[model samples]
Structure formats: structure tokens, C-alpha cells
Target: MKTLGIDIGSSSIKVAVFDAANGSCLASTQMPTDEMIINSPQKGWAEQDPNTWWSYFVDAAKQLSALVNMEDIKAIGITYQMHGLVAVDGNGSVVRPSIIWCDSRAVSFGNRALEKIGVEKCLQHHLNSPGNFTASKIAWVKENEPELFSRIRKIMLPGDYIAYKLSGDITTTAQGLSEGILWDFKEERVSEFILNHYGLNKEILARQVPCFGHQLELNSEAAIILGMKEGTPITYRSGDQPNNAFSLNVLTPGEIAATAGTSGVVYGVSSSIAYDPQSRVNTFMHVNHTTKDPHLGVMLCINGTGILNSWLRRNATKGLSYIQMNELASQVPAGSQGLTILPFGNGAERVLGNRDLGAHMQNINFNIHSTAHMLRAAQEGIAFSMQYGVEIMKTVGVIPTVIRAGIANLFQSDLFTQTVADITGATIELYNTNGAIGAARGAALGAGYYSKSSEAFSTLKVEKVVEPSRNPLLQEAYGNWCHCLNQQLK
Candidate 1:
């Protein structure tokens, strides 16, 4: 049997087929042959049409089906960009462009929530301040676009929207609610406190389903459009970061996962319920969480990572490819010869308490510094930012002695891999797994094809391991980077 996993990412749609027996990827493909568009109608805002995601998903699924027997596909799973708001009317028509995760327009709304709901109360119940999360995004809509809010019969994250399209069902998992800041961690259910504060009807929320269970089934209309069989159960769905952790076999406490895509994330699983008081590092329900076991994920997100790399490539590098830039960066020494980069340019970073300190390059020397030095500093800056947040996780008792990452995106860069390890004093493991494959395995387990989590990820393997280099020089360099970052934040 095979399970299909679809990831509706901020940049593209990726689909994978995995062997349910061994948890190995059978085939995978992404469509458009280019990145999807993220439309920003105004500064600090990010939006995308839900229909565009569906369109690419259909094309990618049909194309993946042609590479194998469609009959062999047993189930479908979806992992999507988290904290996005997708509103649909009673007739299921999209009410407007989805307010995506990184949009910072709701920062004020979230601040109001902290004041009105009381910061202590919010931290106690939601495990973080509501800070520009999905709940605040909806509140923004209700305040600014009252008419649109009136038409909204349902609100969903990007993944939930895709699942609804596939199954003709409108529902969300507890994990999804956690990402949206809608779950009350203390109560282990949706937060009536927040709902009452926002004046949002509990009925507007999707029916809550178990994070990993038989949650949805493919509809005939979706089956015909995607050329798959009807009634194929969508056994699993999760936010991309949580799914990335699940994909990395980091299910148990003390196991940690990191990903550097358009954004950077460090997700650690813990059995204990904890919250970050400042709401900088958000916590959410893990995919395997249950009322009985109570697993939660402590997530640290940096909005600017690869996007800063892309910005440099577009504006600074002029025409050099990323590979060329990497080669140039490799020529520079560890510290980039006193050059430093602050990569918070993408938007207001939650790690910095939702502050929008645009990207900056410090200590540039016109005569001494070269592009190679700037490139190296950029990569190191990203790593330093990650280390900064890891410090917060350490404070909250999710100290990771080692970090696991997939061999994709920035992890594919040797400089980034080593910098992260050396700076944080942790070993870094790179595996040959990605989110779609993880979602597939999760689907198999959720659909009861596998009886245990270990059995589900038995075939998972590591491709490489990076140990922290015992170099005082590198540590000192990171200290300097941290000092510079602290100065900038001040």
C-alpha cells in the first residue's frame, strides 16, 4: 500500500508517495517548475489565494499519480503553512485572499488581546501571547473587514483548507487549533476565553478532530479532479513545522527538529506543559498529542532565513546563483573578517518580540570586505539568530543536546550546518527525510496501517552527522555575533 502526502507550502506545492510498509518514499514531485507567488498588497502583509494552492495541488497530484498505479495509493495526508487564515462563505466560496502566517498586520490586535485578556491569563491558557497568530488574524478581519467577517461560515489554516477541498469536509485538528492560538493548553480544548474576547462564535470554528486519526475522506469531485479514487481517507494533517518534526522521527521528548526553508524553525517535543512568558517562542500541540499523553511542541521561528538569502541573490549578488554564492562564502573564514548580518528584514520577527528591524549589514569595509565575506556573514548571522532563540528554549527546559535536520534548504549548505552546531554547542544530524515523507508515514500510522510509531519510522535513516567543533575561535566569533545582535535589538 502507498500513502500520498501533499504539502501546501508558502512557496510551492510538494507531493510525495510513500510505501506504507517500509515508510520509504516511492515517488515525489512539485509543480509549476518555479516558486509560487506570495502577494503582499501592503507592507508587512502576506496573502495568497487558497484556489492557487488547490490548483497546484491538483496538478502535482495528477502528475504524481501518472508515475505509479493510482489504485495502489491508499490514503492522503496534508501538511501546510501554519497560522494562516482562510475564510469561506456558506457556499464554500473563498471570501478573500488568505492572510498568511508571516503577515504582521495583526500585531496591534494581538497586543490588545494581551492587555484585555491579561498577559498572565493568556500565557497560562494559550501558552503564548496571541501575537499575530491565526486568532488575531481573524480578529483583524472582523475589525477591518466587518462585511467579509459576516460572510465567513468557516475559518481554516492553509492545510485545513486543502483538506476541506479534498474531503468536502470542514474540520480542523487540535494541533491546528494550537498553532492558531485557539487551543487552551490548560483546559486541553478550544479557548472560550479568547472566543468571548473576540466576540467570535464557537460555531465559526471547524469541528475539532484528533491530530492523527481518520479525520477526512476524499470526495468524488476532488477524486475526479485529481484523478484519484474517491473515499481515500485523509488520515493525517499538521502544520508544516510539526509535520517536519514528525518526519524527522523526533516524536519523543528530548528529540528536536530544525528546518530552514523560507523561514527557520526549531521544534522540540516535550511531555511537560510549558509556555514562554514573553510569547516569543510559541508552543503548540504536537501531532501525536493526546489528552492522556499530552505532548506539546516548543517552536522557535525566525521569519527571515532563506528569504534573506534570496534577497541578497536578487539585490546584492546581481546574477550569481545560490551555488556560486555558497562557493564564495566558503572562501571566507569563520568570522567573515568582522562583517556581520542581521537578517530580520523579512518582517517583524516574533523572536524579537514582533519587532520589525529590517535586515542590516554591520561593519562593512569598502576596501577590505569582499562579497565572499558578506556571504559568509549572512549565513553565520542566520545561525546566530537560531542560537539566540535556542537560548530561550534552554531557559524553558527544552534543552536539546543535539538537533536533527533534513538534508534540504540551508541544511544542505555546509557552512550553515557547521555554524549552527558550533555556535549552539550541539551536534547536528542531517537525515534523508522531508516533510511530505513524514506526513505519509503519519498517514499510515493514523490510518492504522502501522501499530506503533517506531514501526512507522523504522526505515528512517540519517545521511550525515555534524559535531560541534571544539574551536574557541568559533565560539568567540559567535559571542561577538551575539553582542552585535544584542546591540541592534536595543
Candidate 2:
């Protein structure tokens, strides 16, 4: 038997099927994807067709089924990009392109919300300001496209949309609501305060469902289209960061999860309720959160990382592959000699209190700085950006001693991995896993295949562990990096 997990990312849709008995991946594949079109009809806006995700899911699943017995798939779970807004009409048809997680179009609405709700009240109840999250995106729709907004019957995140398509059910979890700034931590329900403040209808929210329960059963329509058995349970769903943490077994307090995908994230599990005053870092309900045993995720996002690296490869490096760029970066000495790069160019950064400080490169020398030095500077800038957020995580009492990440994207770079470890003084462990695999493992537990979390992840092992190289040169390089970051931030 197996469980299937689908992760809808900004860049690609990844699907994985995990063996229930051994908790190992049976098959996994991502489909013929162009980089998702982040349509910027206006500056600082990013939107994507919700239907495109549906198409990618079907395509990826078809490819994955060729390698495994599709009939053996017993459960389905979904992990997706967070803070996206997907509105469906009465007929369950999408009304507009999804305003995705990184979109900054809702900044004005969010700022109004902060002013009206009062910063202290929003922080106390929502654990965040209503900054470019799904709720504010909805407000933007209501004000700008009133006709489309009026026809909305349900509002869901990207993952919720996928689950609805598979199971013919419309529902969301508390964890989902929290990520959208729609959940009230104090009330333990959707925040009526935010709804009232934003003048939104509460009924637009899909019914609340358990995060790790029988969320839905496969509908005949979806089952036939996907070549799956009818009535298979869809057991789990979460935002990618929470699911990433679950995949790493970072469910308990003090466990830390870091990933450098299209964007970067440092998510740490916390037992104590905490909020950042500036709402720079966000707090969301973890997949295992409960009234009795609450676990909140303190998430610090950099909105840069691999995206910046990819940009450098495409625009700056004249079409060098990521591996080629890594090779070039490795050839440069530590600290890039005297060059520094700041990777804050991707819209408004949440870690910088939603500031839109575009990326910059400094201290360029015509004779000394080669493309190798620039490449190294870019990678170091990415690591330094993450380390900056790591400091914020420390302020909230989440001192990460060891960081866990999958061996993909930027973590695949030895220079990036070692730089992160040396700069932050945290051991880095790279896993041969990603978000969807974790969701599949989670589905196995939800389906009663595993009695304990430990059992569910018994086959999960670190592929490599990098301790902070005790090399004094690394320390000196890191000090130079911190100096560069401080100079830029000031």
C-alpha cells in the first residue's frame, strides 16, 4: 500500500508516493512545467492560474503512476505554497487567477488592517499583521473587482483547492487558517476581528477540517480522471513549510527546519505562544497543534535564496546551469575577496518588516572581481540573508543548534551549506527528502499504518551532516559576511 502527496510550489508541482509498510518513497516525479507564470499585470504583483496547478497535478500524477501501482495508493495528502487566495464560484469554478504567496499587491489593504485593528491587537491575536496574506488578497479582490468578489462562494488556499478537486470536498484546517492570518490564536477559531475589520463575509471560508484526519474521500469523478480507486481517504494537508518540518520530524518544540527553495525559510517549532512585534517573522499553527497540546511554528522567510541564485544564473551568468554556477562559486576564495551581495530584491521581504529593498552588489573591482567572485558573493549573500533571520528566531527564544534541510536546490551547493553552518554556528543535516514525501509519511500515520511518529519516519535518514568547520578562515569569512550585511541593512 502507498500514500500519495502532492506539493504545488511556485515553480513546480511535485508528487510523491510513499510505501506504507516501510515509509520509503515508491515513486516521485514533477511534470513538464515551465516556471509558473507569475503574471505581473502591475508591478509588485504575482498571480497564477489556479487551473494551471490542477493541470500540473494531473500530469505529475500520471508520470508517477507509470512507476508505481496507482491502485495501491491508499491515501492522498497535499502540501502547497502558503498565503495564496483561490476563490471559487457557486459551481466550484475558479473566479480569478490565484494571488499567490509572494504577491505584494495587497500591501495597502494589509496596512489599513494593521492601522484599524491596532498593531498590538493584531499581533496578540493573529500572531501577525495582515500583510499580503490570503485575507488581504481577498480584500483587494473585493475592492478592485467587486463583481468577481460578489460571486465568490468559497475561499481556499492552493492546497485546499487541490484537495477539493481530488475529494469533491471544500474544507480547510486550523493550520491553513493560521497561515492566512485568518485564525485567532486566542479564540482558537477564525478571527472575527479580522473579518469585521476588513468588512469580509465569514461564510466565504470553507468548513474547518482536521489537519491530520480523514479530510476527504476520493470522488468518482476525480478517481476516474486520475486512475485511482474510489473512496480512498485524503487524510492530511498543510502549507509547505509546516509539512517540511513534519517531513523532518521537527514536530516538537525547539526542533528546527530550514529550506532554500525558490524562497528561503527557517521554521522552528515552539511550545510557547510568541509574536514578533513588527510581524517580520510569522507564527502559524503546526500540523500537530491542538488545544490540549499546542505547537506553534515560528517561521522566518527570506523571499530570496534560490530565486536570487536562479536570477543570477539566468541574467548575470549568461545561461550557466546552477551546477556550473556552483562550480564557479567554489573556485573563488572565502569572502569573495572583497565583494558582497544583498539578496532582498524579491518584492517586500517579511523578515525586513515588509520592506522592498531590492538586491544589490557592492565593492566591485574591475581587475580583481571575476564572475567566480560574483558567484561566490551571491551564494554567501544568500547564506548571510538566512543567518539574519536566524538571529530573529533567536530573539523569539528559538535558538537553533542544528538545522535540517533537504538536499535540493541551494542546499545542494557545498559552499552554501558550509557557509550557512559556519555563519550560524549550527550543524546542518541534509536529507534525501522534500515536502511531498513528508506529507505522504503523514498520510500513513493518519491512515493508521504507523502507531507513532517515530515509526512513520523510521526509514528517514540524513544523507549528510555538516558541522561548522572549525577552520579559523571560515570564522573570519563569516565575520566579513556579517559586516557586509550590517553595512547594507544600515
Candidate 3:
């Protein structure tokens, strides 16, 4: 028998079936064939219909059923984009469009909340600022859309909403609550102080469930619609980043998981109870976190990463493919011949004190520069940006002794991976796995298919390894990039 893993992401819905015994993906499919649109009702606001995610999931499930026998699926797992706010009414109907992770509409509310709640208290109790997280998004709705807020019977993260649809139960995990800055790290429960501060009632939040194990079972209606077996347990659920780390087997302290997708993220696991005072890097409970054996995942996010590369491809590379751009980048020497680019144009960066310095290209040296210089500088800038956050992450004890990433997205580029390794001074390992695959492995552990969590990773393989280089020019390039970034901030 195989276990099913469903990944709900902003771009698409992916479904996979895995053989738990050997941890092999039996079949997998991604739905809609096209990128889903993020509705921006206003500038800096991103929203998506909750029901649309369900619809796409149903479509993906139908496709998955075509590849494997529905009866062979023993359990279900779910992972989704983090920190999204989904509110449902008493009848479990969506009250409004979900305020997604990229939405910046709640910045002011989150800032005010941080000031009023005090940084020390928030950091001590929640291990993060309530900064544009799900809780702040809910607060924004409560103030601006009172009618809709009144109808909200329960609010949950994106993964919790999917679990609700699958099992007819509304529940969340402490890890989920921590992502929303609603978890009390000290008390080991939801933070009632935050709820009271936001004038929100604790009753509106979903009840807590363990991140793994038999949290719920497939409801008959959902089972019939998706051709899944009724009473099949929903065993595992997590946000995408933590799930990615688990997928990579980066469960111990000093191990880090990095991803360069539409945005960039570095999630490092540490056993120590820690928090970044400036909120430069957010901290959330890891998938395996427990009171007896605590694991905190410190996350560093760059709003711009692959998007900057995509922008370079569209505007600067003269219609070159990503592979071609990487080739051009490789031709250029380190430091891009004194040219530096800061890849922070996507939006306000939390790491940069929520400042939108925009994308900066410095020391262009127009007389000698070519497309190669620009491409190489952009990639190097992203790597330097990650190193910048890594410096701050070190403050909270999330040392990136070894960084693991999937052999996809930016890691697919040799130039980018090498630059990241050289800049961060850490060994980098790339694996041929992803969030959905990790969920499948997690389901195996949660459903007792595997005797221990480590068994699920027995088949996980390393595709490549990158080591830090002792290149003076590479070090000089990062120094130049930092100087330019400091100038922009000033």
C-alpha cells in the first residue's frame, strides 16, 4: 500500500503516492497546467479564494486516482504555503478570500501590535513578531471588514483548512499557531495575550492537534469525491518550509533547509530556545518539536530571489533561458567586475527592517559591462542577501553548519549554488526531493508504517554537494554588495 501526499501551493496543487516501505514515489501529478492567479484587489494585497484551492485539490486528486488504485492509499498528508489566513463561517463556508502569505495589507496592524505587546514579551512567548502573519491578517479583516469578521466562526492556516476539508474537522497544530505568532512558547499553548490584544476571542481559533499522527480521518463525502478510502487517517500536516527541511532529513541542530523559489528562504533547525530580537529572522516550531525535546526552526526570507533571476531573463538577458543565463553568469568573473546588484525589488523585506529599497545596480561600469556581468551580479547579490540573513540568524544560534536544498529552482544553477556556498561558508547538499515527497515520508512515520522517523528517509539520496571556496574575489564581491546595501539603507 502507498500513502498520499497533497501539497497546496500558490502556483499549483501537487499530489503524490509513495511506497512507504522503500520511500519511493510511485506516482505524482500537478494540476491546472498553468500558474494560478493571485488576485490583488489593491496594491500590496494578495488574496485567493479558499474554495478555489479545494477545487484544484479535487482536480489533482482525480488525476492522481488515474495513476494508482484508490484502495491502496493508506493515509493522507498535507503541506501548504505558510502564514495564510482562512476564515470560515459556522457552516464551514469561506467567509472571504484568503489573505495569502505575500499580502502586505496588515503591515501597519502588525507593527502596532508589536509595539503594544512589546518586543520582549512577543519574542519570549511567540518567538516572533506578529508581523503580517495570519493573526495580523485576521486583525486587519476585523477592523476593515467587520461584517465578514463577525461571520468568522474559526480561522486557520492554509494547511489546516485543507485538513478541515478532508476530515470535516477544524484543527491546527502548535507549529501552525507559532507561524501565526499565536503560540505561547513559554506556556506551550496558544497565546491568549495576543488574542486579547487584538480584541480577538480564543474561541475563533481552531483547536490544537499534533503536527503528526492520526489527527483526523477522511470524511465520507470527501472520500467519495476524491475516490479515496473512507476512514483513512490523515496522519501528517505541516507548512511547506518545515516539511521541506524534514524531507531533506535536516532534523538536528545546525542543519538548515534552503529554497530559492518565487521567493528565497533559509530555515535552520536549532535545539535551543531562541529568538531574534530585531525580528530579522522569524522563529517557528519545527515539525518534530515537543516540550521535552524542543526544536525551533529559524527562518530567513528574502522577498526577491528567483523573481530577480526571472526579471533578469525577461528584461536584461535578451530572451535567454535560465540555463543560458547561468552560462552567461559563469563566463563572468566573481564580483561581476566591480558591478553589484541588490535583489530586494520584489517588496518590503522583513530582513531589511521592512524597507523596500527596490533593486539596486551599482558600479555598472557601462563602458566595460555586458549582459554576463549583469546576470552574474544578480545571482551573486541573491547569495550575498542570504549571507546577510545568515549573519542575523547566527545571533539566535541557528548556525547553518550544513545547508540542504532540493535540486530545483536556483539550486539548479551551478553559479548560484557555488556563490551561496562560498558566501555562507557552509557545506551545501542538494537532494532530489520536495515538499510532497516529505509529506509522504512523514505520513509513513505518523501512520506507524515505519518504526522510526529516520526510516522514512532511508531512500532519500543526495544529488550534489557544494563546498565553500577560498576565493578572495568572491569574498570581495560580497563585501562590495554589503557596502552598496548599507548605502541604500542609509
True-structure lDDT of candidate 3: 0.88
10 residues in a row with least lDDT, candidate 2: 31-40
lDDT of 2 by residue, 1-490 (tens): 6899898998889999998787678889885454666787877888889899999899988887789878889988889999999999999999999999888888889999999889998988998999989999999999999999999999999999999998878899889999999999988889999998888889999998888878889999989888999999988899999999999999899999999988999999999888788888889999899989989999999887778887777778888888899999999888888788888877888888787777888889999999889899888888888887888888888898999999888999999999999888999998999988988888888877788888887888999999996656656665776776667668
Model 3, position 85, has a per-residue lDDT of 97
Question: What are the lDDT scores of the predictions, listed in order?
Answer: 0.89, 0.88, 0.88
Question: Model 2, clash count?
Answer: 0
* Best first by TM-score, ranked: 1, 2, 3
TM-score for each model: 0.98, 0.97, 0.95
In the range 1-490, model 1's lDDT, one tens digit per residue, is: 7998888898888899999876678899886676778888889999999999999988888888779876677888889999999999999899999999889999999999999999999998898998999999999999999999999999999999999999888999988998898989888779999999999999999997777778988899988887778889999899999999999988898899999998999999999878788988988889888889978899999999988887778788878988889888999888888888888887789999999888888889999899888889989999989988999998888897889999988898998899899888899999998888878888888889988888887888888999998767667767887788788889
Best by TM-score: 1
Off by over 4 Å in 3: 314-320, 365-367
For model 1, state the Cα shift of residue 68 in Å. 1.3
Q: Which residue pairs show collisions in model 1? A: 345-359
Backbone clashes in candidate 3 total 0
